[model samples]
Target: MHMQTKKNILFLFAAGVMLAGILGTSCKKDAAPDYGIPTITRVAQPLDSASIVTGSFTQWVIIYGTHLGSTQSVSFNDQEVPYKTIYASDSSVTVQIPRAIPKDVTNTVTVTTKGGKATFSFTTVIPPLQLTGMLNEYTAVGDTLILTGANFDLYGLDTTATSVTFTGGSTVNIAGGTASTLKVVVPASAQPGPVTVKGIAPLNISIATVAWYWDNRNFLFDMSNFNGWNGKTYLSSGPDPAPVNGPYFKVAKSWQGGWAWDPFCSNNCAMPAELVNDPAKYINYALKFEMYTPLNPPALPLKLYMVFNSGNFKEFFYDAGGGSYPYSTGGKWRTFTVPLSSWGNLQGFTFSNPIIMEFMLKDSNPSQSNFSICNFRMVPIN
Candidate 1:
């Protein structure tokens, strides 16, 4: 009986060991597949497959490489970029280089994935085309425009490609150029509006539209040129007025007093006759003028008013006491640019006709105020 029990115990122990081995084998988890280290082969545009050596801000880029689907992050010059996972695949990924200023040093594009990380060298570029000022805002056909700014093809190597364009789709030839300046002719077909300069690669900059009514004898009222002023009743000759150098008109008023000036349209004014009949042309146009206030009265509130031909008008008030406007009573010239659109709809008003501009003091105190006016004209905004 003892021998039989020992045999039964040995058989049961062997059976238990086999059952445990089967359960262990069935429950064990499968090992994950390995994706090799990521490698970047080429960077190109998705549509044309054209290789890209440099990239612009917000430009779409496709990166061709191996093991890219697992990428967790991408960056430009250590700055992490936002990307879409749906555009990524095992062999490639589509992304946009962040819209930001490029670093001075060499730029590197990096991709990180569960498999590994990869990097590629690239050149980042930004086109900065800003037009600071023009030598002459008003120019006749075939006249020259001196454009001042930075990042122009100053060497004039590619004049045909580098050009100045007008709103009418007319392009002007680049006569000369420098790093900070460009000389371009006003094409005969060019209309009076904003101008754009095209630079090499990605640079394109535009400036405010050229002035429609510029500072000339017909439009400007200065101590030297008083043709635009209505009369001399409310105006007096400036102090020791020299013809070319002194202020054109000196206006004096006591409390609750004012004066008016009307533009002289019969003179050599350059405003187009068509603009007077069409109020649409008045959009984006502004009246710009320079004013100098004497420091006699420390602070004085002033009100400016404009009356249109159709009996429509608008008023802009400046609180001299609060320094609301940037004018100081220290006899310094300050240019005020007031947009015509500030007055509501001007559909039926005739803009070319004589408009009355008046300035009056708002203060109740019995104090005298004096203001000098110069260089009044109309300029474009866009």
Candidate 2:
């Protein structure tokens, strides 16, 4: 190694380092991006990708724009909603509107990113207060008339207001309610027709009802009205929770006797043309009745299936969807519906001819049994 060669190498390396430093100084690196002031274009729903200017609280929506990839906060009408990083991106933030009732509704969706805050014109509205159905249409006076649906709480139904009007024009406030249910005692005068709900946003709403409060449409027989083929040995009046009709077919048996058809059978009876004409349509018709099984002692809280039959068709009642056998209402005179589709035999067993509708107890008993039931009418469920 020559000393001159070593000196030349050191000089070349120094020159290279100085040039690199000069270049680095001249070409400055870009400052870290703060994704300057987020931008929002339009909001849309995830399904069908439909653009929406307004949406229900708790509904999911996509906020479209730039700088959202670093979203620090997302809110619908100023109400912050929780979101996962996985569902957010620079161009979009997918979030659900907070269910909290809107107070000072600004009607805008806001997004805040590291850069700044941006907002799009959006209205977070309360879901429509819907009264789907009365749990038991024949709810007795002073009995709780429970109506089920969504957004009962959001509506903040001014119960004292004329929010709930019954069939007979009797307006009552909701006594109790949750998100999906509104309960009012059945007014002694409430009739049978469509009920009215005046306390809603934008416009008052009308709630359609099934047969209501002692309404007998395709009238079958009750204990007070049935063919006396089977004597009313078990006909009973309340001190049950409540009673809808005058007398109900309460099983006043040692129920250890189990399985028999005497008290439940109706003679070869005729049904309304609607119920008899199209057997295929029977699937849409429900056999509804007020039923109560005392859950406490002496009132045998046995799980029993309400075996019912019309002609050769045989089935039982439980949940509205049908056939939850060895079943009990647990308690209360709630109406029970058994879809005839469950009675596959009825699929073939329509009454172009006369037939017998009978009720029987199952041989399988919880050692003791008692259930009060009445108003067995076939009503259009659809």
Candidate 3:
């Protein structure tokens, strides 16, 4: 054979061998073996052995079983539960229950792995009870107290089964209730402290502190009627132009170097005789009022003066310009509550015989000075 032909034949043989090797490697496969269905032995806390039949939303739980190492997904109540794979193991998987569990469905936790899925049944409850506020926090014995909150079992689902107890005292009488409101009469012996309400059947408890008093009263001034304000000039009066619509008092101040306006309520304004006659009963009280400015005013200092029958006075200053108080209504009305205790010793001034209530406004800048006031009231603290 010629030398060139021999070389050509050898090159062709080598190329054929390389092609066969490439084909053989491409056809090779190492697929994972199929394991049998996974088994769920129990559901519990990660570090504790106590099994839980009911859990709140957004709670983390542990699933113990066989062949959970390859868990691909998890679901609660047939709804997909987002999870992380780092906590999955051959015998256990840790997952967080979905935060938005359907309120109307039964709860079932399902874990899916490479082998199969395992499901466990349980009850899922809503978020824990929260106390928002009260319609009236100050009440005397035999008075009805209205409490507002979430998940209170208020609808008389089991009238005799639900119980309300005042802390450090006996259970008070529950007059009526709904999901968000509970009406209870303050017992004569009930002390000033936290009140706890527990529901029936699937029991849930919520607690709130109430201010109870023997001589509780609300001295309300609905600024809509300005007849009682003596010798005071209001720039105008009409329906509240702000977002919180109601009757309001409008006072305008010019840029003055000193306090320019003082609005005073005369001593003849009707006040509870007990509040003025008994010093002990008036000690525990608070003053609440609503104030609004077209916008958050700059830090203009405003003062409240409590004039006494003895010619003595006490003063509390708040930044009408939204400085020190750190609270803003954002063009809405802002309700302020000042505890009597915050005023310290009032220089022996008798609160029961207050002669006047005055509002002082001072502005130094050229900007228009304006604000509205309403709902001035004094309420017992406890």
Candidate 4:
């Protein structure tokens, strides 16, 4: 009986050992597959596909396949990329790239990882074209055009630019933005159809289609702010000494110089006047006046004295029939052109000082005479 009991115990122990071995093997088989430390299989980045935008920023390339947790960082050129969100369980990292890299045929991206280092190359592509401001569909020929755009060289509009070109014989004056804006003039040669302007290179797109106005004068006349003369100040009526009609200014009258009605008095004289902000010095030197002869003409002969800064009025005196230049016969408006040459050549007066023109409407016969005055404009002959 003792022998039998020992044998039973031995058999049971052996069975228990076998059962534990089988269960351990099953657990090991059902566990999980091991993909060995994630690896970088030929890391790469989008070729220089960066695009230009009109706003404050631009878009750039991104790298892929730098291995999981092995990747320490992804950078452009050499600048460290600030940590952005990691995507897909360590598969990739999405980041905002910088534009400091110089544009060229090829750019570099560096990916550093625990596994190793990999470099990718891409060519920077030109950005797409876009238009901004002034979206009028139609622009007429001979109309002044102000084109607002971007990406142009500073030395004026490049006629040979591949992206954008002018349709008509238009002339564009460019200013502001290093090489980005164009102020173009619409040409008369352009046809009435839809005219197109394109920006070149990266941005090859049409900006605007301006309609041509056939008659600009008629259009301007209909405008409420329209005036026969250029936009300027005008005084038509006030006191007796003022001009006789609209579009006239009392630059200098007899009241200021005491030359109101008594044409013969020394004080009743018109003074010389100089232009305020004349660019061309010639405009400042010469004097021009349009006058209308009054119905009650002055009986006394009047002389207009053009005095330079040097007090030399004798040299510029107009010769009347009797050693006195007479005022108009008082009937019609007449245009008088006077060249500074008539004044003894003193390099004409400087624009800094006002040209004092004294009108000596003195009546030699002591008879009171008067006349009406009109507009005056002095333009450079050149």
Candidate 5:
């Protein structure tokens, strides 16, 4: 009986060992996943496919190559940017360059994926200087004028690296300003011409050559070379209401009428015209004139019509709709601009001789006729 029991115990041990081996084989871990190597061939702008090798900071770009869909990290010039695996694909990855200023001067973009890493030659370009506008174009001497735009700090614009020149070839001193605005003190030498600006190394810009101050570029009737034709008038030599560069045309005439065609024009002043003697080119220009009306002025403004020339074509000093210019300076001299192109709707139009401009009263009942007009000129709006 003892021998038989020993044999039975040995058989049971062998069976148990075989069962353990079968369980081990069934529970083997799954093969490790296959992750392909990643590489970047080039960078480009999204949608346009424009191969952009270099770009400014914070500009969005696409990395094109193989094995990028599993991107784990992206860096421009060693500046790591926030990225996601979901937004990436095996062929391309869209990312934005970080806004932070990079300390690492490595002009290359590095990308790392589950498979491998890639470093692409790329340069980060700085923002360039751009000019927009000059504030208070008619700034008096010693007064502060501002230049408006972006990236003023980039150039360190001051009296040193930046310059401000007026139309007549006079430059002003910088008064200091912020990143988007530049302040300058207008010198006594500032003339009436296009404003010019210069900055460090290849930064030169010119603006407003024909639009700011009242100039003599295309002067017409300013009560000097060309006087008024007919109207009760006198030149304002001034103290009261202040004197302009020149006296108002036949200063202050009492205009009283009820929708009547009252006349005021240059008796024999025919302009020299613009652009190769083509007066039609005046259409591109702005007709500017200084006008003054006494306090509590007219309900409807003055009219310039071809009543003596063609009768159908007419324009207002302002865009007052046909002959309904409701402009009033209220006793202070103010410049009025009338874009000649605004008259494109006036049929039967042509710039030629017999340019008899008849200024009429447009009110059903207008006040006195002593309105002043001077410095008629055609200038660019710039």
Candidate 6:
């Protein structure tokens, strides 16, 4: 009719140009993706940073290698550490830090993750090298003193802190270091009281420098010797005797022939027999007795004979007869803590040279046994 209506308009313009080239090849294969500029990974800072303690603990950090995940964050010095409590599959972290971080310092640690940000600068936490002022009351053998205070600047008086020990063979020779002072030389079988300074090496790795001393009021002990046990003096061996209660202190089953005071202290058996004068002012004080026995007692081999000041009784035998104060849950109430420095030279005996600490309990496995002495105390620990 008009050439068949222009051949149906040229077949609808070639089907609209084949549907616009198939929507431009499906929008160039579903486009939308640039994602660039992002690739960082840095994390390494942990040799065990902060230190110094008077009390309270928890400071362990390792953070070595291997896919450290969990979108991290740990900074301290630049702030923003918001109590970071994390275990995170063990990349290691305990961080509680702050007991002493002074003296010529430096401390910084940043760790932001997702593969980015890492910084480290450490050193600073020194306050436990204090060997206070002491005017000496008695320190035998070639005595040469003067061991002042303030971190002694890593103490190197005579090459790695040359000499200082006293348990009976004495040795002291630090002769050096002076900003505050430290020039020692008291080595003559040194004994007599208070001279326990410490620090061999370790200003890092959580910190360690304990052994400072200077409170030698000459073997401290007061409150009229804790009001009881008659001016102190009671060892055992004559019919089970070494009692005190009102402050708890006992160990009676004597040991010559008696055997059975452990697990049978008649509830307040006169308060363990009385004499522990709670004079709390210890420089390193210690005394905690606890006993328990009877699984089949009566002699499987047992012997306990205690005597101190009965003539300096071997200077306070800590353990030799058998029950220097046994503890393994035999009857119950078990808690021994004797550490008057193990009574070397009869530690702290001075109510005018008075000391009589005793205890003796034996059963020699004969099968007629029983034992018990629940609690006793004389505390102070650093």
Question: In model 4, what lDDT does residue 156 have?
Answer: 25
Give one digit per residue, the lDDT tens place, for model 3 in 1-382.
9999999999999999999999988898967787658888888976788888777766788888898888888877755676553378888888777765353575777788889888888777656455544554444468776667665542232254566787566796577777677787878777645577666554344455443322123545444555555424652455554423245556555545445444434433334566677655655666766666655564223444343333555665544344543233466555456666676655355654334666555344333445666556676555
Ranking by TM-score: 2, 5, 3, 1, 6, 4
Q: Please, what is the whole-model Cα lDDT of each candidate in the order they appear? A: 0.59, 0.67, 0.60, 0.40, 0.63, 0.40
TM-score of 3: 0.43
- For residues 1-382, could you state the per-residue lDDT of candidate 6 as single tens digits? 6999999999999988888888878777665444222222222234534442221213434443333344266544444344456443324333444433333343654456555555555432444545544322222346556555554554433243545555454555466656455556676456544455444544321121232222222222332244334323322222221221112333323344445333222111111111234222333655544344444433212433333433434333345215532323443333344555665654443312244444444354423323444233343445
Q: Which ten residues in a row have the lowest lDDT in candidate 5?
A: 299-308
Clashes of each: 5, 1, 4, 34, 10, 28
Ranking under lDDT, best-scoring first? 2, 5, 3, 1, 6, 4
Over 1-382, each residue of candidate 2 has an lDDT whose tens digit, in order, gives 9999999999999999999999998899877976767899998988857788998866778888987888888877757877562267888888887887665788888888888899888877666666666677777679787777776556655344436777668888877667787778778788776666556554344455554555576545545665646646766677664567778877756544445443444444556587667777887776667777665544433333443344355655334323433345567667665666765566665654345565645454434446677777777767
Per-residue lDDT for 1-382 in model 4, tens only? 6999999999999999999999888778574534334433333233543432211113433444535555667655555555563222346544445443333333555566655666666333344333332222123344444444444432223344423234444433322233444444456564433334554444344444332212111110111232333222323443544332333432223322343332111111222232334423543333444455444535224555443332444435544324543455345443454555555554533433333333444323433434443433333322
Specify the highest-lDDT model's number: 2
Angstrom error at residue 256, model 2 = 5.7
> Which ten contiguous residues of candidate 6 have the minimum total lDDT?
265-274
Number of the predicted model whose TM-score against the real structure is largest? 2
Candidate number that wins on lDDT, 4 or 5: 5
2 or 6, greater by lDDT: 2
Q: List the residue pairs that clash in candidate 5.
A: 69-89, 167-193, 194-209, 253-369, 253-370, 254-369, 254-370, 255-368, 255-369, 255-370
lDDT of candidate 1 over 248-344, digit per residue (tens): 4455555443343432121223443445666687775666665667655532334444444325664554333355532353655444556667666
User: What is the Cα-based TM-score of model 5?
Assistant: 0.49
> What are the models' TM-scores?
0.42, 0.64, 0.43, 0.26, 0.49, 0.28
- Score candidate 6 by lDDT: 0.40
